[model samples]
Target chain A: MTSRRAFLQRSGLIGLGFVAADALATSERLLAAVPGLDPGDPEVPNEEVARILKDLFGDRPIRKGHLTLDMPVVAEDGRIVPVIIESDLPMTPEHYVKAVHLIVDHNPDPHLAAYHLTPAIGSVAIQTRIKMKRTTWVRAIVDTSGGDVWAAYAHVNVSLNGCG
Target chain B: MAIGEARIRIPDRITRGDLITVNAIVMHPMDTGFFRTAEGKPIPAFFIRDVVVTYGGEQVARFEWTSGVSKDPVVSFTLKADKEAPLAITWTDTKGGVYRQTADIAFTAA
Candidate 1:
Protein backbone atom coordinates (compact mmCIF):
# COMPACT_ATOMS: atom_id res chain seq x y z
CA MET A 1 0.00 0.00 0.00
CA THR A 2 1.20 3.50 -0.78
CA SER A 3 2.00 5.94 2.07
CA ARG A 4 -0.93 8.03 3.48
CA ARG A 5 0.27 11.26 1.80
CA ALA A 6 0.95 9.46 -1.46
CA PHE A 7 -2.56 7.98 -1.46
CA LEU A 8 -4.17 11.41 -1.41
CA GLN A 9 -2.11 12.57 -4.34
CA ARG A 10 -2.94 9.43 -6.31
CA SER A 11 -6.69 9.68 -5.77
CA GLY A 12 -7.60 13.07 -7.14
CA LEU A 13 -10.76 13.12 -5.00
CA ILE A 14 -8.94 15.13 -2.31
CA GLY A 15 -9.25 15.20 1.54
CA LEU A 16 -8.72 11.63 2.66
CA GLY A 17 -5.15 10.72 3.70
CA PHE A 18 -5.99 11.29 7.37
CA VAL A 19 -8.79 8.76 7.34
CA ALA A 20 -8.33 5.03 7.76
CA ALA A 21 -7.13 2.92 4.82
CA ASP A 22 -10.80 2.30 4.06
CA ALA A 23 -10.88 5.68 2.34
CA LEU A 24 -11.84 3.96 -0.88
CA ALA A 25 -14.90 2.58 0.86
CA THR A 26 -15.84 6.02 2.14
CA SER A 27 -15.55 7.48 -1.32
CA GLU A 28 -18.00 4.97 -2.71
CA ARG A 29 -20.51 5.88 -0.05
CA LEU A 30 -20.22 9.58 -0.79
CA LEU A 31 -20.64 9.08 -4.50
CA ALA A 32 -23.69 6.88 -4.09
CA ALA A 33 -25.58 9.63 -2.28
CA VAL A 34 -25.37 11.91 -5.27
CA PRO A 35 -28.38 11.54 -7.57
CA GLY A 36 -27.86 10.74 -11.23
CA LEU A 37 -29.62 12.43 -14.15
CA ASP A 38 -31.52 10.06 -16.35
CA PRO A 39 -33.25 11.38 -19.52
CA GLY A 40 -35.46 8.69 -20.99
CA ASP A 41 -35.64 7.26 -24.52
CA PRO A 42 -36.00 8.91 -27.99
CA GLU A 43 -38.05 7.11 -30.62
CA VAL A 44 -39.30 9.38 -33.42
CA PRO A 45 -39.17 8.96 -37.16
CA ASN A 46 -39.09 11.54 -39.99
CA GLU A 47 -42.50 10.62 -41.38
CA GLU A 48 -44.19 11.09 -38.06
CA VAL A 49 -42.46 14.42 -37.75
CA ALA A 50 -44.06 15.66 -40.97
CA ARG A 51 -47.47 14.61 -39.74
CA ILE A 52 -46.92 16.63 -36.61
CA LEU A 53 -46.35 19.80 -38.59
CA LYS A 54 -49.38 19.21 -40.76
CA ASP A 55 -51.62 18.58 -37.79
CA LEU A 56 -50.43 21.59 -35.81
CA PHE A 57 -50.52 24.19 -38.56
CA GLY A 58 -53.59 23.35 -40.54
CA ASP A 59 -53.73 24.54 -44.15
CA ARG A 60 -50.68 26.72 -43.58
CA PRO A 61 -47.85 26.48 -46.05
CA ILE A 62 -44.37 26.03 -44.52
CA ARG A 63 -41.95 28.24 -46.41
CA LYS A 64 -38.27 27.21 -46.63
CA GLY A 65 -35.99 30.08 -45.50
CA HIS A 66 -37.86 31.56 -42.55
CA LEU A 67 -35.75 29.27 -40.34
CA THR A 68 -32.37 27.55 -40.34
CA LEU A 69 -31.23 24.59 -38.23
CA ASP A 70 -27.75 23.56 -37.12
CA MET A 71 -26.88 20.23 -35.50
CA PRO A 72 -23.78 18.07 -35.20
CA VAL A 73 -23.53 15.53 -37.98
CA VAL A 74 -22.81 12.91 -35.32
CA ALA A 75 -23.15 12.90 -31.55
CA GLU A 76 -20.88 10.44 -29.70
CA ASP A 77 -22.76 11.04 -26.44
CA GLY A 78 -26.49 10.59 -26.82
CA ARG A 79 -27.32 12.72 -23.81
CA ILE A 80 -26.32 16.01 -25.43
CA VAL A 81 -26.45 17.01 -29.08
CA PRO A 82 -25.98 20.64 -30.13
CA VAL A 83 -28.79 22.36 -32.10
CA ILE A 84 -29.24 25.88 -33.43
CA ILE A 85 -31.82 27.95 -35.40
CA GLU A 86 -32.07 31.44 -36.83
CA SER A 87 -34.70 33.30 -38.80
CA ASP A 88 -34.72 36.44 -40.97
CA LEU A 89 -37.44 38.97 -40.04
CA PRO A 90 -37.70 42.07 -37.96
CA MET A 91 -38.79 41.16 -34.43
CA THR A 92 -40.33 44.57 -33.88
CA PRO A 93 -43.78 44.96 -32.34
CA GLU A 94 -45.29 45.14 -35.79
CA HIS A 95 -43.20 42.61 -37.75
CA TYR A 96 -41.21 40.42 -35.35
CA VAL A 97 -41.44 36.63 -35.23
CA LYS A 98 -43.91 34.93 -32.91
CA ALA A 99 -42.15 31.77 -31.64
CA VAL A 100 -39.62 29.01 -32.28
CA HIS A 101 -40.39 25.33 -31.81
CA LEU A 102 -37.72 22.61 -31.51
CA ILE A 103 -38.47 18.93 -32.14
CA VAL A 104 -36.24 15.86 -31.82
CA ASP A 105 -37.37 12.83 -33.83
CA HIS A 106 -35.89 9.98 -31.80
CA ASN A 107 -37.02 10.57 -28.25
CA PRO A 108 -39.64 8.39 -26.55
CA ASP A 109 -41.78 11.52 -26.61
CA PRO A 110 -40.72 12.87 -29.99
CA HIS A 111 -43.00 15.84 -29.39
CA LEU A 112 -40.77 17.46 -26.79
CA ALA A 113 -39.51 21.06 -26.51
CA ALA A 114 -41.09 24.42 -27.51
CA TYR A 115 -40.51 28.17 -27.02
CA HIS A 116 -42.66 31.32 -27.21
CA LEU A 117 -41.40 34.84 -27.85
CA THR A 118 -42.85 38.31 -28.08
CA PRO A 119 -41.70 41.56 -29.70
CA ALA A 120 -39.14 41.77 -26.92
CA ILE A 121 -36.98 39.71 -29.27
CA GLY A 122 -35.31 41.68 -32.05
CA SER A 123 -34.12 38.61 -33.99
CA VAL A 124 -35.07 35.00 -34.56
CA ALA A 125 -32.08 33.01 -33.32
CA ILE A 126 -31.78 30.33 -30.61
CA GLN A 127 -29.30 27.62 -29.63
CA THR A 128 -29.90 24.58 -27.45
CA ARG A 129 -28.77 21.01 -26.81
CA ILE A 130 -30.86 17.80 -26.72
CA LYS A 131 -30.57 14.04 -26.17
CA MET A 132 -30.99 11.47 -28.92
CA LYS A 133 -31.35 7.70 -28.56
CA ARG A 134 -30.66 6.83 -32.15
CA THR A 135 -30.07 8.50 -35.51
CA THR A 136 -32.56 11.33 -35.89
CA TRP A 137 -33.34 14.70 -37.31
CA VAL A 138 -33.85 17.89 -35.33
CA ARG A 139 -36.79 19.69 -36.89
CA ALA A 140 -37.68 23.35 -36.45
CA ILE A 141 -41.13 24.71 -37.19
CA VAL A 142 -41.55 28.49 -37.42
CA ASP A 143 -44.70 30.58 -37.48
CA THR A 144 -44.76 33.59 -39.77
CA SER A 145 -47.39 36.16 -40.77
CA GLY A 146 -50.72 35.22 -42.36
CA GLY A 147 -50.52 32.02 -40.33
CA ASP A 148 -47.90 30.55 -42.67
CA VAL A 149 -45.35 28.05 -41.37
CA TRP A 150 -41.73 27.77 -42.41
CA ALA A 151 -39.38 24.91 -41.52
CA ALA A 152 -35.72 23.93 -41.16
CA TYR A 153 -34.12 20.63 -40.21
CA ALA A 154 -30.81 18.87 -39.57
CA HIS A 155 -29.92 15.18 -39.32
CA VAL A 156 -27.90 14.10 -36.29
CA ASN A 157 -26.51 10.61 -35.81
CA VAL A 158 -26.78 9.56 -32.17
CA SER A 159 -24.44 6.65 -31.39
CA LEU A 160 -26.49 5.24 -28.49
CA ASN A 161 -28.75 7.69 -26.69
CA GLY A 162 -31.15 7.00 -23.79
CA CYS A 163 -31.64 7.69 -20.09
CA GLY A 164 -28.29 7.72 -18.39
CA MET B 1 -40.35 17.13 -10.81
CA ALA B 2 -36.99 18.86 -11.30
CA ILE B 3 -36.31 22.51 -12.11
CA GLY B 4 -34.19 22.86 -15.24
CA GLU B 5 -31.72 25.57 -16.27
CA ALA B 6 -31.29 26.56 -19.89
CA ARG B 7 -28.25 28.55 -21.14
CA ILE B 8 -27.40 30.20 -24.44
CA ARG B 9 -23.96 30.77 -26.02
CA ILE B 10 -23.11 32.83 -29.10
CA PRO B 11 -20.14 34.16 -30.99
CA ASP B 12 -18.50 37.29 -29.59
CA ARG B 13 -17.17 38.40 -32.93
CA ILE B 14 -19.43 38.29 -35.96
CA THR B 15 -19.59 40.07 -39.31
CA ARG B 16 -21.81 43.10 -39.58
CA GLY B 17 -23.57 41.46 -42.50
CA ASP B 18 -23.54 37.71 -41.96
CA LEU B 19 -25.66 35.60 -39.64
CA ILE B 20 -24.23 34.57 -36.25
CA THR B 21 -24.56 31.21 -34.52
CA VAL B 22 -26.39 30.80 -31.20
CA ASN B 23 -26.21 27.79 -28.86
CA ALA B 24 -28.51 26.96 -25.94
CA ILE B 25 -28.89 24.30 -23.24
CA VAL B 26 -31.49 23.48 -20.57
CA MET B 27 -31.34 21.41 -17.40
CA HIS B 28 -34.61 19.51 -16.95
CA PRO B 29 -36.07 16.17 -15.86
CA MET B 30 -38.34 16.11 -19.00
CA ASP B 31 -40.16 13.49 -16.94
CA THR B 32 -41.84 11.51 -19.73
CA GLY B 33 -44.98 10.43 -17.86
CA PHE B 34 -44.40 7.00 -19.35
CA PHE B 35 -41.67 6.41 -16.80
CA ARG B 36 -42.30 3.93 -14.01
CA THR B 37 -41.92 4.94 -10.38
CA ALA B 38 -39.39 3.29 -8.07
CA GLU B 39 -42.38 1.24 -6.92
CA GLY B 40 -42.73 -0.06 -10.52
CA LYS B 41 -45.66 2.14 -11.42
CA PRO B 42 -45.92 4.19 -14.60
CA ILE B 43 -44.98 7.84 -14.07
CA PRO B 44 -47.19 10.40 -15.76
CA ALA B 45 -45.51 12.21 -18.66
CA PHE B 46 -44.46 15.76 -17.95
CA PHE B 47 -42.40 17.86 -20.38
CA ILE B 48 -42.12 21.21 -22.20
CA ARG B 49 -44.80 21.78 -24.79
CA ASP B 50 -43.63 24.95 -26.55
CA VAL B 51 -40.96 27.69 -26.72
CA VAL B 52 -40.39 31.19 -28.08
CA VAL B 53 -37.34 33.35 -28.80
CA THR B 54 -36.86 37.08 -28.91
CA TYR B 55 -34.01 39.50 -29.48
CA GLY B 56 -34.04 43.01 -27.99
CA GLY B 57 -37.65 42.56 -26.88
CA GLU B 58 -38.77 41.88 -30.45
CA GLN B 59 -40.53 38.64 -31.38
CA VAL B 60 -38.41 36.20 -33.36
CA ALA B 61 -39.65 32.61 -33.13
CA ARG B 62 -42.33 30.27 -31.73
CA PHE B 63 -43.44 26.59 -31.78
CA GLU B 64 -45.93 24.02 -30.43
CA TRP B 65 -44.92 20.44 -29.69
CA THR B 66 -45.86 17.16 -28.01
CA SER B 67 -43.73 14.55 -26.11
CA GLY B 68 -41.29 13.48 -28.81
CA VAL B 69 -38.37 15.35 -27.31
CA SER B 70 -35.44 14.03 -25.33
CA LYS B 71 -34.78 15.21 -21.77
CA ASP B 72 -32.93 18.43 -21.01
CA PRO B 73 -33.54 19.67 -24.49
CA VAL B 74 -30.86 21.81 -26.22
CA VAL B 75 -31.50 23.74 -29.42
CA SER B 76 -29.54 26.08 -31.68
CA PHE B 77 -30.29 28.72 -34.26
CA THR B 78 -28.73 31.22 -36.67
CA LEU B 79 -29.58 34.90 -36.38
CA LYS B 80 -28.64 37.63 -38.80
CA ALA B 81 -27.92 40.40 -36.41
CA ASP B 82 -26.09 43.63 -35.93
CA LYS B 83 -23.95 44.64 -32.91
CA GLU B 84 -26.67 45.93 -30.59
CA ALA B 85 -28.84 43.00 -29.40
CA PRO B 86 -28.95 39.59 -27.67
CA LEU B 87 -31.19 36.55 -28.04
CA ALA B 88 -33.65 35.13 -25.50
CA ILE B 89 -35.50 31.80 -25.25
CA THR B 90 -38.58 30.76 -23.29
CA TRP B 91 -40.32 27.38 -22.91
CA THR B 92 -43.73 26.40 -21.53
CA ASP B 93 -45.32 23.15 -20.40
CA THR B 94 -48.88 21.94 -20.72
CA LYS B 95 -48.97 21.71 -16.92
CA GLY B 96 -48.58 25.52 -16.65
CA GLY B 97 -44.83 25.69 -15.97
CA VAL B 98 -42.36 27.98 -17.73
CA TYR B 99 -38.60 27.92 -18.40
CA ARG B 100 -36.53 30.73 -19.87
CA GLN B 101 -32.97 31.93 -20.54
CA THR B 102 -31.09 34.63 -22.45
CA ALA B 103 -27.73 35.23 -24.16
CA ASP B 104 -26.09 38.55 -25.02
CA ILE B 105 -23.57 38.40 -27.82
CA ALA B 106 -22.36 40.02 -31.04
CA PHE B 107 -24.36 39.77 -34.26
CA THR B 108 -23.61 40.86 -37.79
CA ALA B 109 -25.22 44.05 -39.11
CA ALA B 110 -28.13 43.65 -41.48
Candidate 2:
Protein backbone atom coordinates (compact mmCIF):
# COMPACT_ATOMS: atom_id res chain seq x y z
CA MET A 1 0.00 0.00 0.00
CA THR A 2 2.77 2.37 0.90
CA SER A 3 4.60 1.58 -2.33
CA ARG A 4 1.45 2.28 -4.33
CA ARG A 5 0.98 5.55 -2.56
CA ALA A 6 4.56 6.52 -3.21
CA PHE A 7 4.22 5.62 -6.89
CA LEU A 8 1.07 7.67 -7.23
CA GLN A 9 2.75 10.64 -5.56
CA ARG A 10 5.66 10.37 -7.92
CA SER A 11 3.36 10.18 -10.91
CA GLY A 12 1.63 13.47 -9.95
CA LEU A 13 -1.61 11.57 -9.44
CA ILE A 14 -1.56 11.34 -5.68
CA GLY A 15 -4.78 13.29 -5.44
CA LEU A 16 -6.51 11.11 -8.01
CA GLY A 17 -5.23 7.98 -6.34
CA PHE A 18 -6.80 8.93 -3.07
CA VAL A 19 -10.08 9.86 -4.71
CA ALA A 20 -10.07 6.77 -6.91
CA ALA A 21 -9.55 4.55 -3.93
CA ASP A 22 -12.52 6.08 -2.19
CA ALA A 23 -14.61 6.06 -5.34
CA LEU A 24 -13.82 2.42 -5.96
CA ALA A 25 -14.94 1.52 -2.49
CA THR A 26 -18.09 3.55 -2.88
CA SER A 27 -18.81 2.05 -6.28
CA GLU A 28 -18.50 -1.38 -4.80
CA ARG A 29 -21.08 -0.51 -2.20
CA LEU A 30 -23.27 1.06 -4.83
CA LEU A 31 -22.92 -1.95 -7.07
CA ALA A 32 -24.41 -4.09 -4.38
CA ALA A 33 -27.16 -1.54 -3.92
CA VAL A 34 -27.92 -1.24 -7.62
CA PRO A 35 -27.07 -4.32 -9.66
CA GLY A 36 -26.26 -4.60 -13.38
CA LEU A 37 -24.90 -1.11 -13.66
CA ASP A 38 -21.32 -0.29 -14.54
CA PRO A 39 -19.93 2.80 -12.89
CA GLY A 40 -17.27 3.92 -15.31
CA ASP A 41 -13.78 5.00 -14.28
CA PRO A 42 -13.81 8.21 -12.31
CA GLU A 43 -10.05 8.40 -11.98
CA VAL A 44 -9.07 8.72 -15.62
CA PRO A 45 -9.38 12.09 -17.38
CA ASN A 46 -9.45 13.07 -21.08
CA GLU A 47 -11.14 9.88 -22.26
CA GLU A 48 -13.12 10.02 -25.50
CA VAL A 49 -16.85 10.53 -24.97
CA ALA A 50 -17.79 7.97 -27.61
CA ARG A 51 -15.67 5.31 -25.95
CA ILE A 52 -17.21 6.11 -22.61
CA LEU A 53 -20.73 5.90 -24.03
CA LYS A 54 -19.98 2.63 -25.79
CA ASP A 55 -18.65 1.19 -22.55
CA LEU A 56 -21.78 2.21 -20.71
CA PHE A 57 -24.46 1.38 -23.25
CA GLY A 58 -22.82 -1.44 -25.24
CA ASP A 59 -23.93 -0.60 -28.81
CA ARG A 60 -27.43 0.37 -27.83
CA PRO A 61 -29.08 2.70 -30.28
CA ILE A 62 -29.13 6.35 -29.23
CA ARG A 63 -32.02 8.12 -30.93
CA LYS A 64 -32.38 11.84 -31.33
CA GLY A 65 -35.20 14.13 -30.04
CA HIS A 66 -37.40 14.14 -26.89
CA LEU A 67 -34.93 16.42 -25.13
CA THR A 68 -33.73 20.00 -25.22
CA LEU A 69 -30.09 21.05 -24.82
CA ASP A 70 -29.54 24.72 -24.18
CA MET A 71 -26.30 26.65 -24.02
CA PRO A 72 -24.90 29.95 -25.15
CA VAL A 73 -24.00 30.08 -28.84
CA VAL A 74 -20.80 31.90 -27.89
CA ALA A 75 -19.33 32.03 -24.42
CA GLU A 76 -17.11 34.97 -23.69
CA ASP A 77 -15.95 33.11 -20.58
CA GLY A 78 -15.63 29.39 -20.87
CA ARG A 79 -15.06 28.98 -17.18
CA ILE A 80 -18.79 29.02 -16.39
CA VAL A 81 -21.00 28.40 -19.36
CA PRO A 82 -24.56 27.87 -18.26
CA VAL A 83 -26.27 24.76 -19.57
CA ILE A 84 -29.84 23.59 -19.16
CA ILE A 85 -31.30 20.25 -20.20
CA GLU A 86 -34.94 19.25 -20.15
CA SER A 87 -36.82 16.27 -21.47
CA ASP A 88 -40.44 15.70 -22.36
CA LEU A 89 -40.20 12.06 -21.37
CA PRO A 90 -42.58 10.82 -18.74
CA MET A 91 -41.32 10.38 -15.20
CA THR A 92 -43.69 7.73 -13.95
CA PRO A 93 -42.76 4.74 -11.83
CA GLU A 94 -43.58 2.50 -14.76
CA HIS A 95 -41.22 4.45 -17.01
CA TYR A 96 -38.81 7.20 -16.19
CA VAL A 97 -35.48 8.70 -17.05
CA LYS A 98 -32.71 6.62 -15.56
CA ALA A 99 -29.85 8.94 -16.27
CA VAL A 100 -28.66 12.05 -18.07
CA HIS A 101 -25.12 12.24 -19.36
CA LEU A 102 -23.40 15.50 -20.25
CA ILE A 103 -20.53 15.48 -22.70
CA VAL A 104 -18.26 18.17 -24.08
CA ASP A 105 -16.65 17.00 -27.30
CA HIS A 106 -13.56 19.19 -27.09
CA ASN A 107 -12.75 19.28 -23.41
CA PRO A 108 -9.77 17.48 -21.99
CA ASP A 109 -12.37 15.14 -20.54
CA PRO A 110 -15.32 14.82 -22.84
CA HIS A 111 -17.47 12.95 -20.37
CA LEU A 112 -18.25 15.84 -18.10
CA ALA A 113 -20.97 14.54 -15.79
CA ALA A 114 -23.75 12.01 -15.42
CA TYR A 115 -26.87 12.37 -13.36
CA HIS A 116 -28.66 9.24 -12.23
CA LEU A 117 -32.22 10.11 -11.42
CA THR A 118 -35.32 8.44 -10.13
CA PRO A 119 -39.03 8.91 -10.68
CA ALA A 120 -39.14 10.95 -7.52
CA ILE A 121 -37.44 13.75 -9.42
CA GLY A 122 -40.82 14.50 -11.06
CA SER A 123 -39.16 15.90 -14.18
CA VAL A 124 -36.03 15.60 -16.23
CA ALA A 125 -34.88 19.15 -15.75
CA ILE A 126 -31.28 20.03 -15.09
CA GLN A 127 -29.44 23.33 -14.97
CA THR A 128 -25.73 23.47 -14.38
CA ARG A 129 -22.51 25.15 -15.43
CA ILE A 130 -19.43 23.58 -16.93
CA LYS A 131 -15.90 24.37 -18.03
CA MET A 132 -14.91 24.23 -21.67
CA LYS A 133 -11.36 23.93 -22.93
CA ARG A 134 -12.41 25.53 -26.19
CA THR A 135 -15.27 25.76 -28.67
CA THR A 136 -17.06 22.45 -28.69
CA TRP A 137 -20.30 20.59 -29.07
CA VAL A 138 -22.16 19.77 -25.87
CA ARG A 139 -24.36 16.73 -25.92
CA ALA A 140 -27.00 15.66 -23.44
CA ILE A 141 -27.97 12.03 -23.57
CA VAL A 142 -30.90 10.59 -21.66
CA ASP A 143 -31.40 6.98 -20.72
CA THR A 144 -34.88 5.86 -19.88
CA SER A 145 -35.95 3.05 -17.63
CA GLY A 146 -37.85 1.60 -20.58
CA GLY A 147 -34.59 0.83 -22.39
CA ASP A 148 -34.51 3.84 -24.69
CA VAL A 149 -31.77 6.42 -25.20
CA TRP A 150 -32.38 9.97 -26.45
CA ALA A 151 -29.86 12.69 -27.16
CA ALA A 152 -29.57 16.36 -28.08
CA TYR A 153 -26.64 18.59 -28.95
CA ALA A 154 -25.74 22.27 -28.80
CA HIS A 155 -22.75 24.04 -30.25
CA VAL A 156 -20.88 26.67 -28.32
CA ASN A 157 -18.02 28.90 -29.36
CA VAL A 158 -15.76 29.63 -26.43
CA SER A 159 -13.50 32.65 -26.55
CA LEU A 160 -11.23 31.45 -23.75
CA ASN A 161 -9.96 28.14 -22.49
CA GLY A 162 -11.55 27.17 -19.19
CA CYS A 163 -9.32 24.21 -18.47
CA GLY A 164 -6.43 26.35 -17.39
CA MET B 1 -14.65 30.22 3.41
CA ALA B 2 -14.03 26.53 3.80
CA ILE B 3 -13.80 23.95 1.08
CA GLY B 4 -16.91 21.82 0.59
CA GLU B 5 -19.10 24.54 1.97
CA ALA B 6 -22.50 24.36 0.27
CA ARG B 7 -25.85 26.11 0.12
CA ILE B 8 -29.19 24.61 -0.81
CA ARG B 9 -32.31 26.40 -1.97
CA ILE B 10 -35.87 25.20 -2.34
CA PRO B 11 -39.05 26.93 -3.21
CA ASP B 12 -40.43 29.14 -0.46
CA ARG B 13 -43.94 27.99 -1.13
CA ILE B 14 -44.66 24.48 -2.25
CA THR B 15 -47.94 22.64 -2.69
CA ARG B 16 -48.58 18.98 -2.53
CA GLY B 17 -47.66 17.34 -5.83
CA ASP B 18 -46.08 20.52 -7.08
CA LEU B 19 -42.97 20.12 -9.12
CA ILE B 20 -40.43 22.35 -7.43
CA THR B 21 -36.94 23.34 -8.39
CA VAL B 22 -34.01 22.81 -6.09
CA ASN B 23 -30.69 24.57 -6.45
CA ALA B 24 -27.37 23.88 -4.81
CA ILE B 25 -23.98 25.53 -4.96
CA VAL B 26 -20.78 24.25 -3.49
CA MET B 27 -17.51 26.08 -3.05
CA HIS B 28 -14.43 24.29 -4.36
CA PRO B 29 -11.52 24.88 -6.69
CA MET B 30 -12.47 21.92 -8.93
CA ASP B 31 -8.88 21.98 -10.07
CA THR B 32 -8.33 20.11 -13.34
CA GLY B 33 -4.58 19.51 -12.85
CA PHE B 34 -3.97 20.56 -16.44
CA PHE B 35 -2.72 23.99 -15.43
CA ARG B 36 0.47 25.18 -13.77
CA THR B 37 1.36 27.78 -11.24
CA ALA B 38 3.65 30.74 -11.77
CA GLU B 39 6.60 28.58 -10.72
CA GLY B 40 5.61 26.10 -13.47
CA LYS B 41 4.59 23.43 -10.99
CA PRO B 42 1.86 21.14 -12.26
CA ILE B 43 -1.38 21.43 -10.39
CA PRO B 44 -2.83 18.13 -9.39
CA ALA B 45 -6.46 17.22 -10.10
CA PHE B 46 -8.70 18.02 -7.16
CA PHE B 47 -12.45 18.29 -7.67
CA ILE B 48 -15.79 16.99 -6.54
CA ARG B 49 -16.38 13.49 -7.84
CA ASP B 50 -19.79 12.64 -6.46
CA VAL B 51 -22.96 14.41 -5.42
CA VAL B 52 -26.07 12.86 -3.93
CA VAL B 53 -29.48 14.27 -3.21
CA THR B 54 -31.88 12.71 -0.80
CA TYR B 55 -35.44 13.58 0.12
CA GLY B 56 -37.52 11.99 2.82
CA GLY B 57 -34.71 9.52 3.48
CA GLU B 58 -34.63 8.26 -0.09
CA GLN B 59 -32.16 8.94 -2.83
CA VAL B 60 -33.64 11.08 -5.57
CA ALA B 61 -30.65 11.89 -7.70
CA ARG B 62 -26.93 11.19 -7.93
CA PHE B 63 -24.34 13.05 -9.98
CA GLU B 64 -20.94 11.84 -11.03
CA TRP B 65 -18.72 14.65 -12.12
CA THR B 66 -15.28 15.15 -13.57
CA SER B 67 -12.95 18.13 -13.69
CA GLY B 68 -14.97 19.44 -16.58
CA VAL B 69 -17.40 21.06 -14.17
CA SER B 70 -16.76 24.68 -13.42
CA LYS B 71 -15.22 25.77 -10.13
CA ASP B 72 -17.79 26.53 -7.43
CA PRO B 73 -20.38 24.48 -9.18
CA VAL B 74 -24.08 25.17 -9.20
CA VAL B 75 -26.59 22.41 -9.98
CA SER B 76 -30.32 22.69 -10.23
CA PHE B 77 -32.98 20.04 -10.59
CA THR B 78 -36.69 19.44 -10.10
CA LEU B 79 -38.35 17.29 -7.48
CA LYS B 80 -41.88 16.31 -6.66
CA ALA B 81 -43.08 18.04 -3.53
CA ASP B 82 -45.26 15.26 -2.33
CA LYS B 83 -44.15 15.36 1.26
CA GLU B 84 -42.76 17.91 3.66
CA ALA B 85 -39.40 16.50 4.40
CA PRO B 86 -35.78 17.44 4.60
CA LEU B 87 -34.05 17.71 1.26
CA ALA B 88 -30.33 17.14 1.55
CA ILE B 89 -27.43 17.62 -0.81
CA THR B 90 -24.00 16.19 -0.23
CA TRP B 91 -20.80 16.73 -2.15
CA THR B 92 -17.71 14.56 -1.89
CA ASP B 93 -14.46 15.71 -3.37
CA THR B 94 -11.23 14.06 -4.45
CA LYS B 95 -9.43 14.94 -1.23
CA GLY B 96 -11.92 13.07 0.97
CA GLY B 97 -13.73 16.27 1.80
CA VAL B 98 -17.46 15.87 2.29
CA TYR B 99 -19.77 18.86 2.47
CA ARG B 100 -23.50 18.72 3.10
CA GLN B 101 -26.42 21.05 3.56
CA THR B 102 -30.15 20.55 3.88
CA ALA B 103 -33.32 22.55 3.42
CA ASP B 104 -36.80 21.82 4.57
CA ILE B 105 -39.61 21.59 2.01
CA ALA B 106 -42.71 22.92 3.62
CA PHE B 107 -45.84 22.60 1.63
CA THR B 108 -49.05 24.56 1.67
CA ALA B 109 -52.55 23.32 0.87
CA ALA B 110 -53.14 22.97 -2.83
Among the numbered candidates, top lDDT falls to: 2
- Which ranges of candidate 1 are over 4 A from the true structure? A1-51, B1-27, B33-110
- List lDDT for all candidates, in order: 0.63, 0.85
Per-residue CA lDDT of model 1 for B1-110, tens digit only, reads: 34657778777667664566666666666665655878998867776776777777766656555544556666655666655666788888767888888887554454
Docking class of 1: acceptable
The DockQ-based CAPRI class assigned to model 2 is medium
Instruction: For model 2, state the Cα shift of residue A21 in Å.
Output: 44
Per-structure clash totals for the candidates? 67, 0
Alpha carbon lDDT of residue A76, candidate 1?
A: 89
Per-residue lDDT of candidate 2, residues A1-164 (tens digit): 56976886777786778889987776466444423223432222223554666666655666678999999999999899999999999999999999999988778888899999999999999999999988777778899998888888788999999998
Model 1, residue B83: displacement in angstroms? 17
Show pairs that collide, candidate 2. Answer: none
Q: Give candidate 2's TM-score.
A: 0.81
